[model samples]
Target: MAIPLSWWLTVAAALFAIGLYGVLSRRNAIGVLLGIELMLNAANINLVAFWRFITPQALTGQVFAIFVIGIAAAEAAAGLAIIISAYRRRRTVVVDELDTMRW
Candidate 1:
């Protein structure tokens, strides 16, 4: 038997929620970046699942999801580079430690 669309959507929503929670609670910059990556993947899953269930005949949703994945990869790379640079300069990756440059 095939899976229901509602179930897929629900799972996607849960993934998004978990990612959001991680982003909100994590103190390490890398952890926050991981959360953002998770959030992006959750969105990608939702898009692909919706395409599979709601519009199987069309390719738009899949195409958009692919674009999102590409963009997400770029974002992750850039974010990691920045995080590395920040850690190099600050000697710590904790969010609380980032406040010194807030001025």
Candidate 2:
């Protein structure tokens, strides 16, 4: 017996909600990045689930998920690099503390 699409959707929705909360509540740059990653994964899950249930023959959803994964990897790399540089300069990874653009 295979799992239902609704189960997958429910899991994805829960993950997305948790990630959203983390992004909004966390002050650390790394934490926020993690939350973003989680959200991306949730989207991937939803895409795959829909693809499997709605159109198993079409590879569009899998392709889209792969693209999303690639983009997420790149985003995480860039985000980490920026965070590391900011930490080196300011010695803190907190988002509120990195406001150097203010005049």
Candidate 3:
């Protein structure tokens, strides 16, 4: 019994929706980061799923997914570093409270 492409797409779409909601509803910096991560993962799933169903012989999908993972890791690291620095100075991780740069 092989899994269907539609199923994969459905799952990815659901994940993307959840991630979008998380990004919009959360008031914390870490929550936004997590939402971004979820969205990235959903994109990777779609890329690999399409590649597998459309061109199994090509390595493009897998390669792109790997590249996306690397980029996500780098983004996470940098975002965390900035969040930590902000927390150290502001003492709050709340998005609303961290808006010191807003003129």
Candidate 4:
């Protein structure tokens, strides 16, 4: 029995929505990053699902997915480094509280 594309799409949509909510509602920097990761994962799922259903012969979709994963990893590393530096300077990881960026 094969699964349908709609099912995969629906799941991705839900995951993306939840991630968006997390990003918008969270005050902590780490929480926002986690939301971003979830969104990225949702994107990955969509890409793979589409590739599997639309063109299983082509590897482009998987290549793109891998690229996205690489980018996400770099983003996470840089984001964490910045967050850690900010926390060391300000002692808080709350986004609204970090106002040092404002001129």
Clashing residue pairs for model 1: none
Give the lowest summed-lDDT range of ten residues in model 2.
Answer: 94-103
What value does the lDDT take at residue 23 in candidate 2? 98
Q: Model 4: runs farther than 4 Å from truth?
A: none
TM-score of 1: 0.93
Point out the higher-scoring one by lDDT: 1 or 2: 2
Better model by TM-score, 1 or 4? 4
In order, the Cα lDDT scores of the candidates are: 0.91, 0.96, 0.96, 0.96
- Displacement of residue 26 (Cα, Å) in model 3 is 0.7
Q: What TM-score would every model get versus the actual structure?
A: 0.93, 0.94, 0.95, 0.95
Candidate 3: misplaced stretches above 4 Å?
A: none
Model 4 per-residue lDDT tens digits across residues 1-103: 1889999999999999999999999999999999999999999999999899998999989999999999999999999999999999899999999986698
- Over 20-65, each residue of candidate 2 has an lDDT whose tens digit, in order, gives 9999999999999999999999999999999999999999999999
By summed lDDT, which 10 consecutive residues of candidate 1 come out lowest?
1-10
Pick out the ten consecutive residues of candidate 3 with the lowest summed lDDT: 92-101
